[model samples]
Target chain A: MITLFGVGCLVFLVVCALVVARTRDLLAATVVFAAYSLVMALVWQQLQSPDVAITEAALGAGITSLLFLLAIGRTRRTEDEEG
Target chain B: MRHVPALLLLLMVAYVLFLTMAEAPAFGVVDVPSRNLVVDRYLDPDPEETGVPNAVARIIFDYRAHDTLGEATVLFVAVGAAAAVLVGRPGPFATRPVTGTDDPILRTVARLVIPFVQVYAVYVITHGHVSPGGGFAGGTILGGSFVLYLFVFGPGRAARKLSPARGEMVEGLTALWYILVGLGGLLLGASFLANAAAGFPLGVPGKLLSGGAIWLIGLGIGLKVAATVANLFLHLAGES
Candidate 1:
């Protein structure tokens, strides 16, 4: 059951990564990248690396997302080009 | 064009992950090398030799003190580079001009959350001996609270609380403190960062006031890192 859950998380991570890469809208891509980090953190937790998991949660999910959001707020998104 | 290279990079990363998975040990199985070299020494530390409550702290501030110093230097350099690039050539409009409506709900939520975040950050820093978190982790949390404030209150407000000059001063002084500690060891006819040989008093184990130089080193690192990261974000926000 745990293995199944890990696999599910891995799949979600892959999907989120793909979404982040393929999406042209910068805001959407940033949000998807944040999701990717979150899922990756869960995968680390499943691997029983609580230390790495906590670091990932702090860095990957928290700081990276905050940085991305700040960048997005400063720059114009793809959709904003039409305006 | 950009997408092609990105996709190729992703493919490479996936391939590496697959290879790692293939060669990986079973879940919860400790690797032999780590078990023998690192874990063994820490778990059954020589009680007669180095009396420290946290083995990890002992390793960080004693055995691997030079590495910690180097890591702190890296943070200092990063913060300096970030400031140089972001703040040195700031235009007349570099100041973050507030242009948005201040939502009362958002402000209230931030006011509520900031205190808890600060408390948690302090807890993580002080309890590094008993928990998985240490200086770097706790420092990042503390830095994050400032980042949260920056997002809600704008860069100008955050800068008032954490000025660039003060941040730089703290970072520089922390680096100096680390070096001075190492020098103290050297002056004692021991190698740099020689915690045991330097005659640092190893107080009662498992207490907050114990761990000799380790606790002080952790505090130094925590303060330096928190200031460094906060300054980086502040400079970036100021530039934008």
Candidate 2:
């Protein structure tokens, strides 16, 4: 069951990564990236590195998303198409 | 086609990476060279040597403290550089009176939830030596609470609670405090950041007051990180 969960997390991570890369809506991408970080934290915990897991959850999911949200708030929410 | 060359390059890079991975030692194998005597020295000591039951904490706060200090310096410098770029500019960093929401639900929930978050952050920092979390995790959480406050109550009130000047003061002083603690080891005839060897008492391993300089250093790092995070948000979000 644990192995299944870990595999599911990896699959979800790949999907999130792809969506973040493809999405033009920067806010949506940032939210998806936060989900990616959350799952990555869980993966770290499953790998028995709880210390890394905590850091990942805080730094990756919490603070980074906030910073990105602020940056998005200041700038355009959608990416501009290149000429 | 245009895509063919890019695809070929990608394949070549992937092949090279796979070759490198094949050459590397297997993960989680005990007999690997990566699992050397140094690893054993850290793991097998039973917490008596470092007085930190958490091996990860022992390694970071005690065995390899200089690297941790370097990490702290990096955070400090990054914050400094960000402030330099943001403060003097006329864009996002411009001072503005915060427009706090009058939403009663947000105000009520924030009032109710923020204290518990602060308390949990304290727990993560103080119990670091014996637990999973240490300075960085706890400090970010502490900062996150302040950020939530800023989000709900706005920067005017948040600034009153932790002004930019006060935040900078806390950041610098906590860093200096970490160095002062390290200097104590040097003054005692041991090298910098020496814990047990410097003649400081290492109490019972599992206790809160156990890990000597480890505990103190963790506290300093926690406060420094907390200040750094909150200050960065205040700057980025605009302070009153």
Candidate 3:
């Protein structure tokens, strides 16, 4: 059962990574990246590393996401199209 | 196509990484080389040796405290570099406060949630020795609350609560406190950051005060990290 859950988490993580990579809108990618961090935190917890899970949730998902949002607020929201 | 060679290179790198992963230790296996005697030495010695039930905390705060100190120094230097870069760079919104969101619901929710978030951060820091959290996790949460406040209420009000000068003072003081705690071990005829081996009181395990210098060092790190993180956000947001 736990293995199934871990597999699900891993799948979700891969999906998030792919979405973040494909998204050209900086804001959308940041949000997807935050989701990736949150799911990664759950994976850490499943691996019995709650210390890492807590840090990942707080720093990875929360703080980094906020930082990205703030940076986005300052800069352009979309990636520039290549010539 | 222009991208064909790039794709082939990517596939080649991926195959190499896959081979490397196959050669690595299996997931969660007990007989893995990573699960060496070091793990046993960290866990087998009861709380008497380390003064904490949480083996993670014991390892970080007691056994390998010097590394943690280095980590703290790195955080301090990173924040300093950020402050150096951001401060006095006259962007239009650099000095003054960026007006906060005027949304009533967001403001109301922030008012309601900030206190709980801060309280939980304190809990994570204080209870680090007994639980899964430690200074880093808790300190980030604490800074996160301040960041949320800055988001909802604007830098003007947030700075009034914790001005940049005050934040610098707190950061420096907490860092000095960590060094002082480490020096205590040396003063008491032991190596730097030594806990029970330094002849300090370990107290009863499972208690809040059980870990001798571990709890103290954790507290210092918590405050220092909190200050550093908050200051970083404030600087990056053009307030500091």
lDDT of 1 at B141: 85
Error of 2 at B11 (Å): 1.9
List, residue by residue over B21-66, the lDDT tens digit for candidate 3. 9999877678987787888889865777877999999999999999
Q: How big is the positional error of residue B202 in model 2, measured in Å on the Cα after superposition?
A: 0.8
lDDT at B51, model 2: 88
Lowest summed lDDT across 10 adjacent residues in model 2 chain B is found at B91-100
Clashing pairs in 2: none
Question: How much lDDT does candidate 2 score?
Answer: 0.89
Best by TM-score: 3
lDDT of each: 0.75, 0.89, 0.89
Off by over 4 Å in 3: B91-97
* Per-residue lDDT of model 1, residues B1-240, tens digit only: 769999999999999999989887775667744467556666665533455655666667777888889889888888887776777676543544333239898888988999998898888777665555667778888889888888888877888888889888989998898888788878988787777677877666666666656767887887887898788888777623
Clash count list over all predictions: 0, 0, 0
- What are the runs in model 2 whose C-alpha is more than 4 Å off? B92-98
Global CA lDDT computed for model 3 = 0.89
Residues B75-190 of candidate 2 have per-residue lDDT tens digits of: 99998987887764667435343456799999999999999999999999999999999998999999999988988888888989999889999999998998998999999999
Interface RMSD, per-candidate values to 1 decimal: 3.1, 2.8, 3.0
DockQ of each: 0.40, 0.59, 0.60
- Ten-residue region with minimum lDDT total, candidate 2 chain A: A74-83
